[model samples]
Target: MASNRIRKSALPGFRFSIGFTILYLSLIVLIPLAGLVVKTAGLTFPQFWETVTSQRVLASYRVSLLTALFAALVNVVFGLVVAWVLVRYRFPGKKIIDGLVDIPFALPTAVAGIALTSIYAPNGWIGRLLDPLGIKVSYTPLGITVALIFIGVPFVVRTVQPVLQELEAEMEESAALLGAYRWRTFRKVLLPELVPPLITGFALAFARGIGEYGSVVFISGNMPLKTEITPLLIITKLEQYEYSQATAIALVLLIISFALLLLINTLQRWTNRRLRSA
Candidate 1:
């Protein structure tokens, strides 16, 4: 009997496209990641563990993770509001506000760093206002979180905006007609549909925060075991020609980021499944 497999998919040149995709991914993504792992293999197991778990490295990890978490959470809340406003309301300068949302995407990271540093520096306008209040932003972990929040907001807003735009206001109206309160309608009707994409946005923001270096190094003051983030430490190691140690720390970061992203994505999938079945 002949095999029943289709030789071609509906997409033109499907096999060729798939082959090219795999080739591209292998060459660009997989190979480099594999190389990083291989380089880290130069260290003994004990050395690898110590390099990744040293006091300074651990502090950096904590700083990165905590700041990313805070930023992601903040974005989830404010981003939802921004997305809702843009999609559901008509107001003056709406188009301009929408355009502004993409500014962070276009801006260079270094420029963002410099702009943020200038705004939040001790002598800068906002910084000077906050100085007497003892609320320092520049060169602190708080400043790092603020920068991450700035860059991450766009991710959440963009992700949720499309979904919100597609959602029918009639459903919300019907809920209200049924005597559903505003809070209850949003909770029961809107929240379910939004959860998956919201989680996706949160994951994206968190991932970006983890990898952020340029925008953070300037604002963080790069203080060892204080303001230093993991990526900055990796750069420090690279600058000192400690390739093995750098790769080891990178590997640990890779593992942790992968695990967190995997967990959030799993939750997203679960919510999607539940919504579909509902």
Candidate 2:
């Protein structure tokens, strides 16, 4: 008696594919990060501590973190509303409106910075109107938040849009039939389903804003210890030929970002688990 055996495809074996994937990731991601860590190693403990914990550096971190958080929060609310409208309603210029959501995605960061600066500058059209009220938009912390919001809005919109489309109308109908009011239905049924994607989008936008330079630099006025952001501080360090100090600050930023992302992931997982159990 003889037996026949099936063999896997030979075009690309699993082992070969995985090996290539690891190699690609190492070359593109891990290696550069390792280099950064190594460069930062050149700094003494006191030097590294001084570089990252200085008042100016601390202020930049505070501004960057707060602005990013505020922007991400704003996006979460508006993004959900936009996604819901697009998913549930039909109107004139619907396609055009949908296309407009992606404009930020296509716009260059520097161009966005310049455009925002012009519109918000004291003598510019909109700014001129607000100037009488003493509402300064450009060259301030508020301006940085505006820039982050501009660049971050699309992330939330795009993330939540597909989820909205896939949500069954029957669910809403069932909730209404069960005497759930609109707000109650949304809070109890729709919002839970949206949470995971919303959190993911928030994390992405926050991360992007933390590292954002081009769009924020012009609008923020790059005033050290005031409106300056961490990226600009990093650039300033480089300009002054403080390579070790720059890398030290970069290392601190990398660590903090990694920790924040990990925390967000943990919270997302917990929310998902609670949703499933409910």
Candidate whose TM-score is highest: 1
* lDDT (C-alpha, whole model) for all candidates: 0.90, 0.88
For model 2, the run of ten residues with the poorest summed lDDT: 1-10
For each candidate, give its TM-score against the true structure.
Answer: 0.90, 0.88
lDDT of 2 by residue, 121-154 (tens): 9999788998999999999888999999998988
- TM for candidate 1 is 0.90
Clash count (model 1, backbone only): 0
Per-residue lDDT of 164 in model 1: 83
Worst 10 residues of 1 by lDDT: 1-10
In model 2, the clashing pairs are none
lDDT of 1 by residue, 138-208 (tens): 99999999899988989999988977877778989999999999999999999988988898899889999
